[model samples]
Target: MAEKTALISLNMGGPDRPESVAPFLRNLFSDRELIRLPGGAWLQRPFARLMARLRAPKARRAYEAIGGASPLRIWTECQTRAIGRLLGEEWRTAVIMRYWEPRAKEVLTHLRREGVKRAMVLSLYPHFTAATSGSSINDFCRHAVRFCPELDYRLIHDWFDWPPFLDALAHLVREALARFDGEQRHRVTLLFSAHALPEKLILEGDPYLDQVRTTMRGVLERLPEYRSRSRLAFQSRSGPVRWIGPSVTEALDTLVDEGVREVLVVPVSFVSDHVETLHEIDQGYRDYALRRGMTRFERVAAFNDDPGFIRAMASLVASRVPASWRDSRQNENGAPCQGTP
Candidate 1:
């Protein structure tokens, strides 16, 4: 019924305000695919409400520490706008958050109203996992069928080793490493961390770990000097359920044992800053490392709206979108970025 094409970006959105935190937690905990409760499916909602009620206070404090809210929605908006501009007026761009506002249903309905006939649904997750990307994609498709069955959408799931993506990561890593001078540059162990997943998911043949490892290898290949010190660790591990190992704390402990005082942590999995990087590693890990006798700690600034990251994503959009509908705009104003105003 429509003619133009669309590019839908998927991300795990965060609470923009203090009041939204409880609801975000509830939605996150209630997701059966992302988290499995002790009881069966029938109990998930009840458990979610209780858990969210209990956890909200600490979560709100965490948000408060990081400027009273998550910058994810703002950053996602900025990133999507940049991507949209790059693709031109011919292609409409929008973002869908997994556990927050502007979710799949809302975005799909908006796209339908905008008269988008075909779409390239891209996962912001570079690595594919059932818990993250899978859940987002499944949610999008389920709602797409119900809300806009006539619209055609093609999925662009993962690009863990995509050259441009890897390059963007390398650029940030190099930028972070430059902060150190002389021996500290090479002395700092590159502690790469990613949000953790339940151990059950990995044991059941999820390729998330494998894909993340691949991304690490790609990044190391680009920066061979850091390869010797670079190591992968997991962060943001929650729940009583068994999750991935060599957590940020454990990794810090090992680095301390090895007489490594300085660490340059790279969030290998996330493309932008969220609670994981801004709060967990920046605050929690940094404080722990300091108390544990480490001298210096640094994190690779997230590639939020860096021009290079935008170019890479633009290339991805161009490739995934049908050539017939693809239209590259010639902008007299090159590489403009917008922030939350």
Candidate 2:
């Protein structure tokens, strides 16, 4: 049993509300942990400000397509509540979206005010990448030390290789495969799509690509039946820089060109259906696939509130927390940590 309790912090991604787009994106771009800039700080702010102004209108339109705002926060709240329920009243959990409401700084401030003695920084992202989890962890580290200097911190870098997470992903994929029609089942090709990172980052020794590959490997090892048909793809890349390729849309087109009529897209990167999954995959890519003359283009549902997923998350929290909180700290007596470390 632990002598002290630990609070878990989360980065739930960003929002898409019309009114909030500029501020939200500005926050995103301002994070030095993301969008690394070479110019002076003064120039960077103006550059970011300008980009936010230019991008907000177009961003607002996309958000408007799927109801006037992003549903990511709602999903985050659901996850927070579910985790809270599973952890019970002993361990308090608060979510902080890096570029949206309940921002990271605010959550840290709240935890500080609550007098938390220890904390666990958990990015909703299971895979580690400088662009995603690294950015959030860097921000938390920078601020939390000054904000709560006395607190002990345990950061969960990644859960990409955990067994429960792998199991949950496998279970979800299996369930989706079972639902496919007889003609679609054996003929279906699996497309594992993830958010893209610049080629520069991969060359710079960022483990994002490797970690994702491990995630793919774990999924494949658990699915002996699907191994022969699945392929990996990348998506949602921005800017002019070269990104990890065999882009999802390009892959979809190629599959169609090759006479493969049915394809199942698994958004293995994201835990929730955010703008990328909800709009990009469902609307943009689905439209592209339909236009390319593909007969079926079904997306595996995001992990959202799946019981297996929730249980996996609970298990992660349980394993990470001290025994004093849950009264079962012994290694053999308590559940072992099972997600991507």
Best by lDDT: 1
Residue 148, candidate 2: alpha-carbon lDDT: 68
For residue 117, model 2's alpha carbon misses the true position, in angstroms, by 1.6
Model 1, C-alpha of 45: deviation from truth (Å): 1.2
Can you give the lDDT of residue 303 in candidate 1? 93
lDDT tens digits by residue: candidate 1, 18-75: 9999999999998988888767888999888988999999999999999988998888
Q: Report the C-alpha displacement of residue 70, candidate 1, in angstroms.
A: 1.1
Backbone clashes in model 1, listed as residue pairs: none
Best by TM-score: 1
Query: What is the alpha-carbon lDDT for the whole of candidate 1?
Result: 0.85
Roughly what TM-score does model 2 have, to 2 decimal places?
0.90
List, residue by residue over 1-341, the lDDT tens digit for candidate 2.
24334445566466655788788878767765556677767766876788888888888877888887888877877876787677666666777776677766677787778877765556788888887787767666766767767766667777888899999998888888887888779899889998888788789888888888888889989987778888899998755468988899889878888898888888888898788887889998999998999988888889888878888887886677644444544433322222223
* TM-score (all chains, Cα) for each model: 0.93, 0.90
Assess each prediction's global lDDT (C-alpha) against the native. Answer: 0.85, 0.77
Which regions of candidate 1 deviate over 4 angstroms? 323-341
